[model samples]
Target: MIADPEGTVLALFAAFCRIGACIMVLPGFSSFRVPVQIRLFIAVAVSMALLPVMWDSIYPRVQGGGSNYLLLVGVEMLIGVTMGLIARYIVLAMQFAGTGISMAIGFNAAPGGGLLEAEPEGHITAFISFTVLFVLFLSDFHHMVIAALVRSYSFMPVGADFDPRMALMTLTDTLAGAFMLALRLASPFLVYGLIFNLSIGMVNKLSPQIPVYFISIPFILFGGLILLYFGSQSFFTLFVNGFEPLYLGLP
Candidate 1:
């Protein structure tokens, strides 16, 4: 038989690897601004705290060095990635909203950094996306993510093969729901931009000499700012509320 202490340590290390990999990509914890060393340290600390509590359940299965070991590791990775992807979709909802708002407000013309890598997005859209992501961390929603991580082992134990078809379907459904939520959040801005532009166009046609584009630019800017200020509280509340459901569903 393998030594008890060595087996325990290996199990803990394996668990930490899975958790760390997930956090590396999960929302709230996966910020480019955070130093990699700090993230690794946090992951290690979390795994250490959890190992003792979870060892009774996870140790027996992982003790033996055989085919089961590889299978368990794979399951752990799949569970971790699924959980992270669920959280990621929640953040994507915000990005979708930001993109919609930017397009409606005529700010989509300006170029900015991509959301992940090489995915082109507008400047205003990028700003809103980053702000929402930052706010998620600031609000301590990351605690929910960690909780989900710990809870996942219970729902999806080691050595059990997950259904890849179900995983794919879940991802697809989550993304579609996220996009729909974004559209809802940005609908007010879209409607306002539409109506305002239509009215301006009518006025310009009525008096072709007038410089309607120059005149209405300031109005639209001020209107958008005021709308954002008023809508921000609702937006954050909606995002947090929506995020909880998605987090809970991840397996």
Candidate 2:
């Protein structure tokens, strides 16, 4: 059964190239906290597991080694990265919303460590980001992503023609969707901040001697925190619900 060990090994690496690249930029798997060795091992293990299913398509290509093989490998990387970016953009959108929510709620503070990157984030923003990521994990996001990848082979086979225009369009659409989602999630905070600040600004004009602005901080913080406490569960639920349709349901 294992007559062509070298051929099988080459095919395996070919599969690994794509999968490993995807894991490099995938959301939870790509976090700075996840060690490189662990990610590499996961990629290899996934490639091996998937090799049997993809063998018919990939083995023939590997057998004919040369420019075509190299090109196929390159295309696989492109496809993997593109798929990873689709999901990554969604996560970034949530992080963007977290940042905006913090600003709106007057919770600005010294930047804390990022949940997925080196970039600093507000304390509350970091909390929200990590919590949502945890929820995604519990929801078996990885299984969904891998399933999507398996399905991708049917539509975008190895060494498929890369369409830059189509890719750009998809990126633009994702950005637009992400922007809209972020805005929706943060809208309540925006409205509350606006009303609170306006009322305080007017009070300051009327009673400039009362230090109205200074006194408003505690109340603003209290009200914003209360709103966040009540709204967080629903907010995360909406995000989780939308993520699958937006990325996995792609035509």
- Which candidate number maximizes lDDT? 2
Q: Which ten residues in a row have the lowest lDDT in candidate 1?
A: 108-117
Model 2: lowest-lDDT 10 consecutive positions: 242-251
Indicate the TM-score of model 2: 0.95
TM-scores, all candidates, are 0.87, 0.95
Look at candidate 2 and give me any clashing residue pairs. none
Q: What lDDT is obtained when candidate 1 is compared to the true structure?
A: 0.77
Question: Model 1 clash pairs?
Answer: none
lDDT of 2 by residue, 14-90 (tens): 88887888888989899989998999999999999999999998887788577887888888888888888888898
Q: State in Å the error of residue 93, model 1.
A: 2.0
Alpha-carbon local distance difference test for all models: 0.77, 0.85
Clashes counted in candidate 1 amount to 0
- The reply for model 2, stretches above 4 Å from the true place, is 249-251
lDDT of 1 at 238: 80
